[model samples]
Target: MSATMEPRIQYAKTSDGVSIAYATLGEGRPIVFSPRVFGDIHLYTNVDYRPPYIGPLVERGWRVIFYDGRGTGSSQRDATGGDLNRRILDLEAVVEAVGSDRFALCGVASGGPAAIVYSVQRPERVSHLVLVNTFAHGAEYFESIPSVRVSRDLRHIAEDQWEFYTLALANALNAFSDTETARRLAATIRAGVSPRAWIAQRDALEQIDVVDTLRSIAVPTLVVHDRADTIGDFSMLASKLASRIPSARFVATDDFARAADEFMREGEAPPTKEEQLPSGTAIILFADIADSTALTEHLGDAAFRTKARELDSALRAAIREDAGTAIEGKLLGDGVLAVFASARQAIEAALSCGRAGDEAGLPLPARCWCGRPCGRWRALRQACGLRTVAIRR
Candidate 1:
């Protein structure tokens, strides 16, 4: 894109009926940017304001995609933008509209959680991940800095005095810098989101806790943050995120785009053959506690999470022992997903998962279900590309 013209703005409707505004630049392999909830597409495109690092990505032959999430920019403003689920919806809508079979995902600041969640859920679609200045848990990110945590109560100020709050927020994110860029950023933020919407989004962000899901990410990831970060010392958060994921590298550099490009280039391993998807005649296994909501209410969130994690690990281990591959990222909710090469393996794994759940004393007997695919496994093949059948035990 030249400095003289703005990228064309477009829209995509989410499954839940939210319309997301987005813009794309350059061509070749795709790289979608998930900006923080407060980003403005117009402001992002402005040569004077757009992050200097992003332009080089376009120059490097990447089809860079940018979008404004719900409640911000040209998107629907009546909704909240910070919750991970809603952010996922925004990203899903944009990606489906743009039509990339597999692409690198770059998530900035608060938007990183959405990117992480997406990578975990749809490993086949995302080639790599770039997480910048973000954390997995909202509470952990905020409570580490008292002022930042306390700032939530002051969210009301956004509704009452938006101009003041946005300026203060702009400075806070920039370590209290008072540059012309900061002033412009403050104005952009104000134009991107209304005060009421910001308040709603902030409240929703506080409820997000995707730390438990981080370990499921299997894609190559680049975690970036500033060493001298002043807004809650987020570098540690970024470091912790990198350390947990099996395939993540932590880097603290000013030239993030260049670093990301170098890292991706070094790690790039294009598939020489078609992606391996499970097919033929196989059985799928699923084991989960029945009525988990009641159990969570009884055990409390903390205790329930610990028990659930333990049970999940045990079930996965059993699945592996039975010669089955655990599909950890699918729609299991409180359950676990596993695919087996045979009915005997699937049934045995299902029984073991049930036994494990019982031994874990989850208070409710775990339910087990498995079955075989009817012929071509078209549902799995066409959609997730996962080979799956089913079993009941």
Candidate 2:
């Protein structure tokens, strides 16, 4: 539950006059994190999310930078523009502000497209490129994800039930197992944007197609995806994207954090024990009682045991049906731990488990110290299930 300390927030001015908030942290060669809509600088600087991706680099003397693109986080909120070229203005502002003549570029999820375009335009400055759980073309995402159409997607949900949307996204990303982390992500997202602004901004960013730009990249590139990702055929598409790049060679590894490290360390010697390859991550789920003793005293041991067993059985059935691995152990008699492959599967199965507990008349509850852990698990799950791609040289 611990995380990297939050640095002082600094501002960068985009050509559009949007003031981007960013932080200059760590040491060594520089690496810039492209912006994400769901998270701001506050979320990334937390324990769960940014550390696994940036921590090892920091220790190895890499100066990693993080920033808010515009609509989300600490940046200008009222102007939630969806134009891709305009978004890159935010990136340009950050790079100029830091004055790092050369640096590596890493992009994850929705953040990748801008980073790709940026590298293409500034080939001389961007030394290496890393893309994780992202796609080359925006349309591929819409076509691949189940039941997600251009007319109906996150924007619609953001309008009707913004809080619910945030929680659901957290569960999908977190693997539906970590209740606490999901709650925290939900809170962070709720704070990041309003329903109106989210819809307004997502109009353009819903899908960031850059198929034509892939081959234009001159830097060494790493494109990573999880083979097990059940978010449609996004992994396959990612591999195809990597193949388009002349300088890119594909790889499959659970420890791509190491792949990223080694790729970024292109000019350096062999890797040491100090840094670790990023591993394929997954989310875990559990059902726990807030006060087992109190409930037991009220229900009587025999009746409580019978109901608990029934609830567990129902939960396990849902897990099996959804193709998730239910871990058997004593997380406590009333609790169960399960692993899921996809965000959609995890969310659906967890909801079913919650229903089982309710139907069995058991009051189960647990709170978490939410920060970055929730989404990290989900991102890991997504990456592990999708295929992985790294630099050729």
Candidate 3:
């Protein structure tokens, strides 16, 4: 079964004399794959059940590197073991040993924070970075997310039966796999690393929070995540990461695990315009008239339609004068949806429209808006459903 190809696995000694084991495969620009805390990098190489994107990356003629962290797999455990900082240095050691000063880095899940840290600390050594299903800080507001658990709770559970915890860790990491694949993953862990180490490693993740570390990274970065992930909402995390890194871009997906795989392989670059925020320091607004159908019936189509036209005129004038972009005000039965750029401008436009409605002795629909320091008005626009226009001030 292992005969078709053989990976040239080797051992390298870090400055601390810890023997780090790494396997280099394929041939092209180096792409180092840093798995999540509970992940086995070797699993990407095992064809019996390889990850979806790993084989594809190999087929694309990219050189891929996979190595165990200091405390896991074939790498010797750090006697003076510490948290992610120490682990990150371990990665640095490996990168130096690999003899390439710069390469593309693919970090998934918990490892993502470390990748950013490394990129910032060693900017000249990274060409591009891919962060999938990652977090920037301690998952303080992420308790409601199902993929993660409270550190104290996991610690308590691990203290009692480390072996069960190891198996559980393996199962949790591969939660989306089919029954047979999950079984194989569990077996692989049981044979690869001890229960004690797994527990220690799991405990280490509790101390990681890299929110401040991401800012210094200047390399081009891609952040991908599942739209519905319980791991603190990948979209939110991606947004945070992308916002901080000057050259970072965010990509949202519905599949939790597959998104990570696709990013590791750089699967297809999203359509050019879709790859980034439409504008920097700008806002988007959406305003929808309330109870349009009922309003139409109550006012009679002719009168309601007249009121809508008046409202549209007031909205368009206010938005354009303020440099706000507007979607055509369309009547949906008895309601209208309008978009704008600036929060204050949208609010001003809505309030002005209301004044026009009042002059006609009638109430318009509802109105709301949001603003940001960075001027990315989208989050607010989505939340309040309003169109936005950019204001010069």
Residues 50-120, model 1: lDDT tens digits: 54444456645578889888888777777664677888988999999999989999887677888999998
Whole-model alpha-carbon lDDT for candidate 1: 0.70
Error of 3 at 275 (Å): 31
* Candidate 2: residue 3 lDDT (0-100): 25
- Residue 336 in candidate 3, Cα distance off native in Å: 47
Q: Is candidate 1 or candidate 2 better by lDDT?
A: 1
lDDT of 2 at 31: 90
Over the stretch 208-316, how does candidate 3's per-residue lDDT look in tens digits?
7777777777887888764443234556656766788776777885432344335544656532222232253444433445566786687655335444544544444
Model 3, stretches more than 4 Å misplaced? 1-5, 45-50, 77-82, 141-144, 150-152, 170-181, 226-233, 253-393
RMSD of each: 21.1, 15.5, 18.8
Worst 10 residues of 2 by lDDT: 384-393
Give lDDT tens digits, candidate 2, residues 328-387.
322444576565545567677767776666666787542211122345544533544422
TM-score, every prediction:
0.63, 0.64, 0.58
